[model samples]
Target: MASEKSVRIKDIADRLGLSMMSVSVALRGMPGVSEKTRKAVKACAAKLGYRPDPALSALADYRRRVRPTMSFAQLAFVTDYPVKDDPFWGYTNEFLYGAQKRGQEYGYNVVPFWLREGGMTRKQASSVLFNRGIKGLLIAPLPVEDGHLDDLTWKYFAAVAIGPSMASPQLDHAVFDHHHATQTVLRQLHERGYRRIGFLILRRRSTRVHHMPLDAYLGHQYRHEEDRRIEPYLPEALTAEGFWRWFDDQKPDVIVTDAPQDIPRLLAQRGLKSPLDVGLVCVSGQANELEGVSAIIQDLKAIGAAAMDRLHTNLLRHAYGPPQHAHGSHIRGHWQEGMTLKK
Candidate 1:
């Protein structure tokens, strides 16, 4: 007698003088197997000490769930943003495009679920998604203050978050390589004969990314000449008054910032012009918007695509709830030369 682990359904079928299909249906209690045959199959299975193998069941299930031809399931991009103020349409639109494209490759369509407009509580939204057969979630960036995602039922789905903004529940995340981005910016500025570089960042943005930029900036300055080191001005929010004060005090030859929209005007107000009186560089800049500012083109879409990839892998492993050991995937961005910084 073979061990139960070595027994196959076909082996039972051979002994019972029934077809493999009948044996399978009977042992599994499917409709095609009558009561007498089902009982006989069960008795024989017991006598043979037969047991189902989870690995075989999982393999069959995986084959059933994923096919090369077309999508069989959906992934949700869950956000708390109001439709009108959706970040996806603004700075993060590229991220959405990336996620969608990658998801399609794996036969999964990524759909947006706006949490605020629907007026559904997190639990309600979870229920709706569960009913709709959504098994994976790509949690987008939320307000920096709202670190935890305790509102959603974490156990029901496999999830990965976009960026450090999703702090709690601590799912695996994909983020811009802010630390590297900052380093690249500083190195570029140094190579271009600029010193006394100051960073002006809104406190919220700095906090949202766990101060990686700040740490990188400080670390870089530490190893450089003392004259080249300038203190960063981190106001609670960006303001013209605060900007001038920092400008007057630090006298940075070049300013590095995430928000560059107001820098041109701010420079103008102080009787300064970019690349002449001052060099302004945006650490995170979109190609189209920051027309004249030298910047690091953060690949937001690539980050989204990475997050989708992580979520897909988790779903394949049937991983749910908080990860046992959370991880982060960092994406490096490229530098775009603009008119604001000296070439």
Candidate 2:
């Protein structure tokens, strides 16, 4: 049996009739070697029981930290939203910022690529990414009508989707725990003496995420009396007229919605007030920033950082393509108190 010390990169190189430099580059996932050559080199190394030297890896990591130019790893944040009026602008910005910040810490540059603006088909985009040496992807939550990216070359890179929107490739995902977030908010509201808490969201948004929040709400309702449970107010789109109609019909003591904007305004139109006549809470992003609103604030920045962490872990383990087991991570959002909910 060949011992670890007996197997080396040069030994594998000589057996494969390749240069030591080529073998070294292949093992490190550098650009010098073709993908086929890299695969061959890795196979040979595995057959020979080759293991990397921990000290050397540590040294390389230190050098990469001290001198970023020494490393060439690049990742991408793929999205369809444009720079202006981005659908996910406020909600997903933290994810972008966190991914970029953490990626840099690991000597990997994470850049954003707008799929719509590029005017390229999925195949064309893949070619561009391949030529640019982008070996990792952080897919953002997509619009309801378009989410799947099946044409992209999955085998060539590691990928982690931000949410359930990118469902086709079924890549590993990092997402806010919508179920837990809803349960938490309901629990808090109940504790605060709110019985009839109404849940509201755009129908498309809820359906896009497989109605995880709605599921939680439905599940929680069973725990309370029938009158205490309010059916969710799902509208096809936002309109003051539609919302007012629902509000009037439900007559809820509190409202829980993804969009907290205009809740006060809508309440004012009915000669009502938040926490005085009706209470309000948000199960969305930017909750802490909402004045007078208690919320289950989704920490998008933390979710982004977590996604990068998962990507890096896969890179280190030589895991690529759609994950065999398709691991997913759900980060629970925190409860933030403002003046929206009564004390």
Candidate 3:
């Protein structure tokens, strides 16, 4: 039954038989408070359910002869996809949850802004953020065809890219090593005595032109002298019919893809059971379980959380410029062994 009105520092101080200033320093973990006294005050404060009003604390500090401290107003999570329909919402939700938890601990709030709403141009987005006094940004992976953000100025705020390295010279990014991930999957398939491996991917200008996984798949296929097949589906196509036709024709013994559901359904339609006539491995498994599909699970949630951590570090150090290629911190893909692969 403790409402916000009853959870003040004075209530705690009165109960603990301590001065407000002593209790304040102890609660804030500032110096000048003895260890024993601090512990006692903290225990009493917890017992009374005392919580400091952040707004009032900021105001009080400003009114005193103290130098103004930069309070975290808002950190913007910008994405090009529509909020409701984007397939990557699950990943985004995890990222936001991680960010919110960390932001609360550091005294900040995260604000999400979708690019699909109202046709947000870079200039318009920048103007809106500037007006709202938001100086931090975390950009999720945008379509590669959208190209680099040319309209937004990087000098005004700190920013970080949350996925693959876009061709932007004015941003810091944290991205998974797509080549490494593909190599891992291919190597696993190779070790399992599966020689004829094929890759299916959506053919997009962005993917064909810039995606590294496609290049890696092609390179690996050529190097091993394995019978390689590629079924390039239309970028906008997601029907089972097109996938079934391709599956019937290629008839690869083992295949790797991003969509697990489509692969299983296609196989089922063709009267081919997985791990019997064909093998399956999903490159980026987004679903709850692999079901029958073996997958190279890239922990995207961890990637997003790490990106925020890097962004916060850069902001604190005031380092803003082109994306520096970070060494030593590699994005490792975890292999989930499933029943889809043949022994």
Q: Residue 73 of candidate 3: its Cα lDDT? A: 55
lDDT of 3 by residue, 235-289 (tens): 4565777666665676667877776777677777768878888888887654465
lDDT of 1 by residue, 171-233 (tens): 998989999999999999989988788888888778878888999999988998888788888
Candidate 3 regions off by >4 Å? 1-73, 82-90, 104-107, 115-124, 143-146, 205-209, 226-251, 287-289, 321-330
TM agreement with the true structure for every prediction: 0.79, 0.83, 0.66
Candidate that would win on TM-score: 2
338 in model 1: Cα distance from truth in Å?
A: 1.5
Tell me which residue pairs clash in candidate 3: none
After superposition, which runs of candidate 2 have C-alpha atoms over 4 Å from their true positions? 3-37, 49-70, 82-91, 238-241, 287-289
Give the clashing pairs for model 1.
Answer: none
TM-score of 3: 0.66
Clashes of 2: 1
Better of 1 and 3 by lDDT: 1
In candidate 1, residue 162 scores what lDDT? 87
- 1-343: candidate 2 lDDT, tens digit per residue: 4687788878998889999989987887755678799999999999889998889888987876677664647788988665534754666777889998888877788888876654788778888887888888899887654477888888878889997788687888898899998989888998998888898888988987789989988888888788777778888987889988887788899998887886787778778887899989888666556766788877888899999989987776667799878889999988888888899
The per-residue C-alpha lDDT of model 3 at residue 113 equals 79
Clashing pairs in 2: 292-340
